[model samples]
Target: MNKKIINKYTSDNQASNLPDYQQCYQHFKWPSVTTQLNIAYQAIDSHLNTSNENKIALRWLGKQNQCVDFTYRDLAEQTSRFASVLNTLGLESGSRIFSLAGRLPLLYIAALGTLKAGCVFTPLFSAFGPEPIRSRMEIGEANVLVTTMSLYRKKVAKWWQELPHLKAILLIDGAGVLDDGCYALSKLMENANAGLPCVKTSPDDMALLHFTSGTTGKPKGVVHVHQAVVAHKSSAYYALDLHATDIYWCTADPGWVTGTTYGIIAPLCLGATMIVDEAEFEVERWYQILDQQQVNVWYSAPTAIRMLMKAGNEIRTKYDLSHLRFIASVGEPLNPEAVVWSERVLGLPFHDNWWQTETGAIMIANYASMPIKPGAMGLPLPGIEAGIVKRTNKESEQATLEVLSEANQIGELALKQGWPSMFRGYLHQNEKYQHCFTQGWYLSGDLAYRDEQGYYWFVGRADDLIKSSGHLIGPFEVESALMEHEDVIEVGVIGIPDDIAGEVVKAYVTLKSGVIPSEQLQKQLKGFARKKLGAAVAPKEIVFRQNLPKTRSGKIMRRLLKARELGLPQGDISTLESDEQ
Candidate 1:
């Protein structure tokens, strides 16, 4: 029999003596699962039935500093009209709709409208170049695409016809006559009725498709169901201390899971007023937005927090953040320094939380009411069961995973597989999806440990992917892109520690036989990578290496590369073939 460890943070579980899962399910009110459920209806239409119909659902800030406020009623009408347009276009139920825009109102409308239409909504980062956009759309079998005209012309125009499955390309900000196969989004909305009925959807129906990169392959698409709304609402209420009427802002792009889950769905489900800024991260502007918007609850990434820290205290002191009560950081682990900095400067400690694209929602979080553990990732959300497990059979493809009972033992972080928000499976990758779970636990590739108080601490990734500025960059993806360049023969990419970003992508490359590693060549390679993979996934620094450490099987030892770069202890490496000194 396996040993299970359940540590108690508080001694109040007397009535039922039930586990956290039962306690949470019994404590919170979940929508009736027996009836049909649509995330859009739960997020928008339900609010419309309440007295809060006129309440502000979204406050969108335009690029020119213009503001547009959408009430629950207004949002419902807009989303219904968009859904009507989708139906008019002959898109079938369960069709996949992809959004390739930024934090615009139209993108949010498209997301919810797609959900209301019973179409799976997948969002891509607006900064993504032609290839990433094309690959994701192709993988998800995207039926309808909603994006701006400029993005279409810049990124999608060339490849739009290549995807046979893509039927419609709706341009949100298009003016003048529509392109050959494209339609103006605003004109379609104008022509459609605003009273379309929401599609009846089962809880298990696919609602969202999110793409995340692995260390060694193309991006994997994770599927989430409409039932995920249950966990999202509960987590937002408990983890974020979000309240109805509270002005909230989450600094994540709609392209990412955090953006879709928290930025759009969670706040709306809570009936909170959400602030959306159409601008990049500038310290002064962010401070001004916080003050002017009177934001009560704020969620951001560790990279942004560190950047704010770099901006110094004088800039922050000038702004009035008196309205701010809670601030939380996600995307990556929040360093202890940033947490302390937030407490001292921002007047509140930045709560840290942990989750993945596969989890579909936040699994563990530092609550607003709980005592702060600066660097710890906090306890599992009431219903989530997290454990540290060791692979007892690493040599076999099918390994035996044993959950560690002792506290503070370093091992892979694994979560029990029953969360409502947990991803159903990786799209079209049944074997890969099955490989992720063993002994009924979803193995998170991250290495972490939990303290006796149940606070989980992040160690490092078990894989070689780089997380820079809250974006996951696969070394394989970057390496493959760099290998496309004429001068590069082989490349090993690793993340190096930085004060601002938790890690920055750094590449160590070996040139082709005749090609010399010159400064000009390095610059050209960097430019090529930026062009191919986009700046976010491109390597920030490049170093010329005679050769990269590899195993006898020719697998690049990224761990050795990272260890050598960071001057960290190089653990046992008896299988090493050779090192380039």
Candidate 2:
């Protein structure tokens, strides 16, 4: 298969971009490596400090009916003040600060403030339970933390007494009322200088640390530098078709890398407005925002789209969604069915895209004007080079890594290195970091075969594959088949520990609306799967559920499912829903 980007830009340094104020945009100029990260600094000075300061950047809503709007100017001043406090507290550059809070503005403040102060910021999943949260904080060696009063009083309230590395906790809503031991964020910011000087930082300076969802036990910290943000902006602009006038609402939570990239920096870097909602996924509420906010480019996950499809088209048809220009999918690969359903009901094909938390932004995507196939993850964006490598046949007559140059061949997808947003490293884990790459090619654990048309077809994770009766089966293929059943709203397939066939596929499924829980429905669904794909790939066992556990970004936690099935420790339950808990 050929590389994804049809065109490549000559070097102008890796941090280049067209002026945000340009009247007409044509070709994009990628920034050189020597490009200044002061773009973010200047944005704070120009668009934010002027007439648009009153323009809202985020609309945070609460479960208790409280609402708050943060304008760009408000964000700048608050972050600047917090920067002053951070410096005064002896927090130096490179000092890591791990932060968590229920979808709120303080998460943004702490992140930007940490960066403005020349310190690195790490985000922990707000939904993570105590152990997972503590694991990340301890692993990151975060000297300070910023969170809500309730989270501090309930979660970290006991953590401080245990893990001593987290020296300080800054509470957003607990000011004045918080325990004397914990610092009040509002009071500190009030005491700080709003005119605090911005620190001069290199593009390569450690900017953010995100924890990857480890299919294997412990979560690994992925490090991204300040320069990576610029890379994220360039790629996100093209991949997601984000424009200055575009009112983009990225549904990813701040707890994930996509949230920090698209929801925060990418929009600000280009001087575009970003929408933030503090509420959880509610189909009717989501459509209401699309109409009210006029969200132009909608980027969410396949899981969300499926959930939306289940809600039916009545709510979708009610909205005057003429404003929505494009839609895209992430987190998990989008099924062909979801793509078609989105176009029929939402009035547009929800484009499928692929990327990892480590990569920062969309590396491969189906853009607004790009040609899109129903099931294929479209071409790689400009500046990214990819190829498929056939699995090592230990029993091969001749030995070599035969990169597939022909169509209809399945192989491992690997990226050519030196991309700006490529993760710097796994924090505190050198050997572990080295495992994902060979030479410079980042070995994406995903197995995808490239077609002659330059589109990539996803197989499942390298580990999620099951070998049954000596035949290899991708869990996604089986899971997708199961999802076709009307009774199956969600499905997760794993190779159960089996005796004879080496491994047997067992599907854990969630029922859809109007489907009453009964063995008859389960039997019919299993029979349907058998007729659809063949008995070999059909689930040996069918387990029904009220809901499938998912991350805040709407990705089903497959590892969590596998962990639970074998009575093993469920890894990184931080993103697990409260209802699940």
Candidate 3:
């Protein structure tokens, strides 16, 4: 694709007129009927024919300071070998493949190679305990599993027999594995052919399966087709401002949708060099990597940003980050404090975006060329039609939708149904999938409002909204307001049972280091909240905490906190990051 044609689909990095939903779709160049449109082919194989063949595709940094580089040609050959290995195992094209490892080179190979082989690929976060990993593998009906020996022993070996459909287990990191049809990944790759061609599949063919947590019961398995790559490529270009020469770093784990889309697919499809770090989050280490790697674009989560804010600004002076041009945050609503703090300290304010595991790609984002509203989620992507809508009837299963025309009216953020990346279905839950849509729009399950300038402002999850007295309150507003306090490090807000109001706002706070938690300080914080937010909306109860419950992905689990506080069932503690007493 030429620069002009690519920019026609992926909008230019300039504040220009964005095409409508239909126009954006029409601009994309879909593959011919006879041709295969594998994501691996787009990301790796296609680049081999051009000058990008020898370009650095991935730069991996190991825990012990070891480093490795994978060129586009190297990636193509390695992935082909992986695909050939799968073929030798007598596995069918449509089989399900799962990768349950850290951000290692083998895991990346499995992700791309599995898709290139016309198999559906699912990624499980390595931090997940045994139960969570087993549950996801079970739900996805994983046929082939690619993981390290350590993870297999700790997380999979115990329940390996439970999954009857599991065929082969490829140990990517260790030797001496032959039980239960398991084999060494390196040996298999070495023995297999490296000249295997990419599988030919239709646009509607299953490509990826991603699991998202539900408020109750088991996680929902979101299914996406090969056609979704069109959206992934375009969204990355427009939202991230990714260029062929830019070096990018996406800190999200590859198991998450953001990591799969932006971290693996988008950057590579655009021929950008990606930096992958296996080390855990450390403020100084992250800064050093950014400075040393010369990362032009950085994609990360809000929790990491909050952690950096707690690390203080003086530490930043030790490193040079002049090469960093753009930064973005996802996974949750980034509070206004982070935006301002970044601008003051890092010289670049983080642009927050909104999307879901179901959407598969970024739906709304603050463009590099556009003016940013500190807390807004920016405008809808070129191909997305977003609106604030309310269900006509809550009690009915087939409830219809009514789009709210007024600006700043809190309602469910809904999207029109024609986006290429819109999820096809929730696996084995057809009824549940149908419930996600009302009339024509896809109900995002997120409560938000749009201002006159077309910026979407997040409120909170619909079920997470707190009703106190006669007013509807979103926990994010209270939490953001509380975060502005100098002594506050992190905070979570939940609605507790109140005699008169039915429910009242309660705040659990973690103080900054050396900040004493005293009655006088509590009173001071209460007054601070009251000053920022009106009496009715400000937190009525304040409790001290060393930390609050959070998901591994950095989202505060408000429901878990409320459940624990009320002595209720703590459903699914699988993804809990920090369990504070």
Candidate with best TM-score: 1
Candidate 1 C-alpha lDDT tens digits along 1-581: 11121122123212233254445635644445766888999999998768789999999998789999999999999999999999999987899999999789999999999999998999999887777888889989999999999889888998888898999899999879877879999999998889998999999999999999878888899999999999888889878889896999999999999999999999999999999999989999999999999999999999999989998998998899999998988989888778767877988888899998889888888876566677779888877778999988788977898889999899999998888898999999999999889989999999999888677989989888788878788888888888888888889999999888888999989988988888888899898888767777788999899888998899999999988887988897898997875
Q: How many pairs collide in each candidate, listed in order?
A: 0, 12, 0
Name the weakest run of 10 consecutive residues (lDDT summed) in model 2.
6-15
Q: Could you tell me which residue pairs clash in candidate 3?
A: none
- TM-score (C-alpha) between model 2 and the true structure: 0.74
Best of the two (2, 3) by lDDT: 3
Best by lDDT: 1
Ranking of models by lDDT: 1, 3, 2
After best superposition, candidate 2 residue 410: deviation in angstroms? Answer: 0.9
Look at candidate 2 and tell me the lDDT of residue 143: 87
The deviation in Å at residue 261 for candidate 1 is: 0.4
Q: Candidate 2 at 491: error in angstroms? A: 21
